[model samples]
Target chain A: MNITTKLNIVPFVSVDSMMKLVLAIGIEQFLTELARYVEEDFLRWESFDKTARVASHSTEGVIELMPASDGKMYGFKYVNGHPKNMLEGLQTVTAFGVLAEVDSGYPVLLTEMTILTALRTAVTSALAAKYLAPKNARTMAIIGNGAQSEFQALAFKALLGIDRLRLYDIDSTASHKCAANLANMGFDITICASGQEAVEGAEIITTVTADKKYATILTDNMVGSGIHINAVGGDCPGKVELHRDILLRSDIFVEYPPQTRIEGEIQQLADDHPVTELWQVMAGKASGRKNSKQITLFDSVGFATEDFSALRYVYDQLPRTGFYEELDLLADPDEPRDLFGMLLRAKQAAS
Target chain B: MNITTKLNIVPFVSVDSMMKLVLAIGIEQFLTELARYVEEDFLRWESFDKTARVASHSTEGVIELMPASDGKMYGFKYVNGHPKNMLEGLQTVTAFGVLAEVDSGYPVLLTEMTILTALRTAVTSALAAKYLAPKNARTMAIIGNGAQSEFQALAFKALLGIDRLRLYDIDSTASHKCAANLANMGFDITICASGQEAVEGAEIITTVTADKKYATILTDNMVGSGIHINAVGGDCPGKVELHRDILLRSDIFVEYPPQTRIEGEIQQLADDHPVTELWQVMAGKASGRKNSKQITLFDSVGFATEDFSALRYVYDQLPRTGFYEELDLLADPDEPRDLFGMLLRAKQAAS
Candidate 1:
C-alpha cells in the first residue's frame, strides 16, 4: 500500500520544529536511526565524487555550498554559520538542501536544515563515538552547551549507551537548558563549573562551542587515558577548539582529509601529520579505537556526504508521515514554447 | 498606502506562467526593459564579485551553481541542461535561484527560473546585438526554434528595431510553434527549411540548437560579413554549433572569460584565444563592431549576474503588483536556543 495519499511537498522543518521532532522521536531512537543511514552510505564511499565545499565569506560570517554525486543522484546543501545571529534572534546554523536526479538534474527534494543540521551533527557525533569511544561508555561531558549541545546529549544516550551527562557552558543558562532536556532521558546530569571539571571522569567528551575562534575547549591535562574527543565546532579555517597537545595524544580521524586539514582542529598540526580516513575505519580497511586505553580523536567538521545521506533519508521517510506541503516551485510549461503566452494569461487572471 | 494587497510571499513565476507574464508584458517591452537592468548592472561591474559557476557533470546532463555577491547581497542560480529531457516530456532546461543577505545568509527571495532563463537569454542576446549588429538590421535568422526562439524574436524587436524573423528547426513543428507565437506580436516571419536558407538577408543570426555536441549548425561558408551571430545554445564543454573556421573570420565577444572558456561556445578554441568581454564594450572601455562589414559573434552562456539582476528586479516588483505567495522556506527563531521549544509548540498546535 502507498504510505501517504498526497505527494508531500518538500517538508520544511524549521529550526524550531526540528528540535521538537528530535524530542518527539526521543533522542536515542533518532540517533540510532540516523547512524544506521550514515553507516550505510559510508560503506559504498567510493561511489561518490566528493569535493571541498565552495564558501563565500563575508566580514560577519560565511555561506557555503557542499555538493556531491554518487554517479546516479546529486545532492548539495547550502549552509551558513553566523555565531552572532543568536543575538539577532536567529539560529547560528541554518541550512537547506536539494537532491536531484543525476540523469536529468531535476530537484526531487528541498528541505530546511536549521533543525536537521542539529540532528545530523548529534547523530554524527554518536556515530563516531560508537566506533572511537571506550566500550560500555556511560557518561558524556558536553562543553559549550549551546544550540547543538542537547542533541549531542541525546545522541550519545541513544547510541553509546551513555547514562550520565556533565554539562558546562560559559553561560550558565545554556548548561541549565541542556541538563533540563536530559533529565528524563535516563542520562544522569552534572552541571560543571568549568570544561576541565566536566571532562574529569567522562569516557567521551563532545565539544560543540559556537564561538568562531581558536578556543582550546579541552586541554591536554583535562583528560586521562582512553577518552574519545568528538570535536564538532571548529569547521572553518582559523576556527578551532581542541589544544594542539590534545590532538597529538590521540590517533586523529577525519572525514575528507583535504578539507579537515584546513577546517578541522587538525589545521593546527603540520601538513604531514599522521591521520586516518574515517571511511576506511568504517569499512574496516583502517582501525577505529585500537584499545580501550588508546586516546582517540574524531575531528568531525561535518561533511557533504552526511548531509547527502540526511537529505536522502528525510525525503524518503518524512513524506510518508505527512509532515510536508507541496510547493508550486518548479515551473511546468504545458506547451514549452508558449512561455510568453502563460505569463500573459496569469496577468489576465490577476487583472 | 500599499500598492499591492494580494500576498506577502514573493510571486513564484513558473516556466509556464513566466511565459504568460512575458506575453502580457509584451516580449519586446520585456526585452527592452530587461536590457536596461542588464546594462545598468554591467556599468557598475566592479561592484560585483564574479566567480565561475561550480558544476557537476554526468553523461546525460550537468547541474551548476552560480553565485555572486555585491557587498550587500548574495545570489545564486541552480540550473541544469539536459538535451534528452524533451523526449521525456520535461523541458530540456529547468532552473531556480535564491537571493540572500550578505551579512546573514538569510534568503530573501527564491524563484522559478526555467521561464526567466528564456527571458534573460533573449535579453542578453538583444543587448549584444544592439551594440554589434548592423544599424539597418531588420530580419533575423533563428536557427533552433525551441523554447528560446520566441524570446529571441521579442527581445530583438524590443531592443533593436528588428520586427522580421527568419526561423528554421530540425523539427518543423518547433518552427511552426515559434512562428505562431510571434504572429500576434507583429513580426514578419519566414520559416526556412535549413540553416543556410534562413540566413539569406538576415542581419542578426541567433543559433540556439539543443544538441550537446560539436555539430556545426552554422558553417563558415554560410555566414556572410556584416552578420551578427547570437550563439545561445552552446553552453557546456564538448558542445558547439559553429565550425572553427567561423571563429577565424568573426570578432567573438563573451561574458566573464573564465566561465565562457568552460561553458560558452569558446570551449572549442585555444586557452589564449582572443575574445573581448561584452562588459568592457558596455562600459565603453573597448570598442564594438569596426564597421557594418565586420562579422560579430556573441557566444552566450547564461551568467550569474544576469540572474542576480533579474531576481532583484522580480523581488522588488512583486511587492508592487502583489501576485506572490510567501513560503516559510527560511527559519526565523525566537529565543534561538529553545529551537526544541518551537517544535513543541508546533506539534501541540497540530495535535
Candidate 2:
C-alpha cells in the first residue's frame, strides 16, 4: 500500500488469515516464536504500563478490556467469557484486538484475537513450564480437553519436548476430539475416563476447563511432590481448578500480583500470601523452581502485556507472510482541521 | 447479508462511510436526531453503567478508552489527544468505537468515531444548551475555530435555531476557514481578531481552543450575567479554558461530576463545590436556567454515555442506509468448544 493509504488503513487478520499464517509457519514454530516474544516482553515488564483487566460482569458471564502500552506501542484486547454460550453454539470466549502507535494513536493492526489469544495463552503456559516444570519431563496430564487443549499439548511438546499426553475432560467427546487432532502430531495419547486416571504417572498437569464457577478438577491426592501444575482455567473471580490444599503445598507463580490475587487460583489465599512474579524469575531477580521435591504452581491469569506482545509479533510477521487485509479504520483528512470540509467533499463525491 | 454470514460479520462504518451517512441524512437533521438520542439516554442515565475514562498519558499525548453499558448494550470509544499532532499535520483528536450486545458480548458494529465523535460532542453541547441556554437564544460566540467549531455552530443552528456566529482563534486562518465552511450553511458569520472581540454581542459564548495547558479563553470580565458559557476545550486534567473567576460566577452544570471535578473547568474549584448533573435536569429532577439574570455554565467535558448513544444511533441507522461494510471480525465454529477443530479444518482446506 502507498504511504498515504497506509496512514488511513489498518491491517486486519481474520480468523481464516490467522489460521493460514499459523499453518504456513507450522504451529509448533509459531508457538515457539510467539513464546520468545512473550518472554522478551515479560523480561522487561517494568517498562510497561500495566493495569488489571477492566471487567463488566453480568448474570451469565463477563466481558473485559485488557490494555497495555510500552512507550512506543499501545494494544488492547476486547474479550468475553460466557459459559452458557456453548449451549447456543457460540464459543465461551471470543476476542479481537488492536495495536496502535503511541505517538500517532493510530491503529496499525486489528486481528481476531480469539485464535491468537488461545495460541498466546498456551505458549505462556509452556514458557512457565520451561522454568517451573520438572527437568526433562516427558509426560503431561491435560484435564480439560476443550478448545485450548490441542494448542497446550503442542506448545509443551515444542517448548519442553514433552510428547506424552494424558487427556481427560468432563465431556468424553472433547477428550476424544483433542486426541484425534493430535493423533498424527507426534504424541502418545491416553484418553482417560477420570481426572485421577489422567494424572496417574504424569510429571506435569495442566487444568483448563471452561466452567465459570469454582470446581475441583484436581484434588490434593491427585497431585504429589515434584509435579508442576499449570493452572490455566481458574482465571476469573470465584473460579478455580486445583483444591485449596494443593495450593498450600505448591509455590505459586503469577503474572501480575494485583490481578492474579483477584482472578488467579491464589484468590483462594490471603491477599498477603507470598508469590513470585514470573517476570522476576525470567529476569533472574527471583528463583523459579527451588527444588524438584517442592511443587511449583503456575497460576496463569493472562496479562495484557502478553496480548501486546502477541500483536507486536503478528505485526512484524504481516509483511513477511502478507496474511492480512487493509481496513479503512481511521479518518485521514487532507487538512487536519478541515474535517467538515472532508465530509462536504465526500457528500459532493457521493452525489 | 444472510443469517449465517451475519453471525460472524460485524458492520464497520469507515470515515468515508460515516461522512456519506452524515451527508445522506443531512448534517442538520443528523445532529438534531443525534441530540434526541443523547437526550433520551441522558434522561434514563440511572439505568446505565458508567465509569470515568481509562487514560494512558504520555509526554506527547494521551490515549483513552471510554466504556459504558446499558443492561442490553455496551459501547466503548478509543480516542487520543495530542496537541503537537496538529503541527505534524495530524488531527489533535481522533477516535473509533464499538457497540456490542451485552448478552452475547459480540460486537454488532464498529465505526470510525472521529467524525461521529465530532457530531456527538456538538450535539451533546447543543443538547445541554437547549436546557441551559437563554430562551430563544440566536447568537453564539465560538472562541476556537478549530475542527469542532463548525459542528458546534451547525448543531446549535439545528437544535437551538442559532443563526449568528462570531468566530475567533489565536490563528486567523482557522477563523477564516470556519467562516468559509459555514458561509452558505445558513449562518451569518463574523471573523473576529480577538477572543474578547468574538463574545461582544453573543448570548452564548463557547470556549473551545485546542491547547494542552490551562488557558483563559474567557476571563471573568469576558463572561456577563444571563449568558450561557459552553466550556468544551478544557477536558483533560491539566487543561482549562475559562478563568477561575468565571467558574465562580456561573451556576455550573456537568455530565458526571466525579469525572468533571478532575478533568473539567471545575478542577479549579474546591472539592466541595456543588454542581448539578445535566442528566437530572433532562430527567426533570433538577431545574435548568433557574433565573434569567443568573449565568449558567455547561461544563462540557464530554462523557461515555454520549458515545454510547451515538453508537446506538449508528447501529439503528445501518440497516436503513446500508452505509457500512461487513467485517469478518469474529470466530465462529460449528461446535463452540472446537475452535481448534476450526483451525485444523482451515489448514486441511488450504492443503
Instruction: Count clashing residue pairs in model 2.
Output: 0
Per-residue lDDT tens digits for candidate 1, residues A145-211, read 8878877877787777788888999999989977775566577899999998999889998898888
Candidate 2 lDDT over B88-174, as tens digits, reads 888889899999888888888999998999999999999999999999999999999889999999999999999999999999999
Classify candidate 2 by CAPRI docking class. Answer: medium
Off by over 4 Å in 1: A1-27, A344-351, B1-27, B347-351
> What 10-residue stretch in candidate 1 chain B is worst by lDDT?
B1-10
- Per-residue lDDT for A1-351 in model 2, tens only? 222245678788988789999999989999999999999999999999999998888878888899999989999999988888889988888899999889878788889999999999999999999999999999999999998999999999999999999999999999999988898999999999999999999999999998988899999999989999999999999989989999999999999999999999999999999999999999999999988798999999899999999999998888889999888877777888888888878877877
Q: After superposition, how far is residue A259 of candidate 2 from its true place, in Å?
A: 0.6
DockQ for all candidate structures vs. native: 0.51, 0.78
List model 1 lDDT by residue over B27-120, tens digit each. 5666677778788887787889888999999999899998888868778889888889887666678788887777877776777787777888
Q: Against the true structure, candidate 2 has what lDDT?
A: 0.91
- Chain A TM-score per candidate? 0.93, 0.98
In DockQ terms, which candidate is top?
2
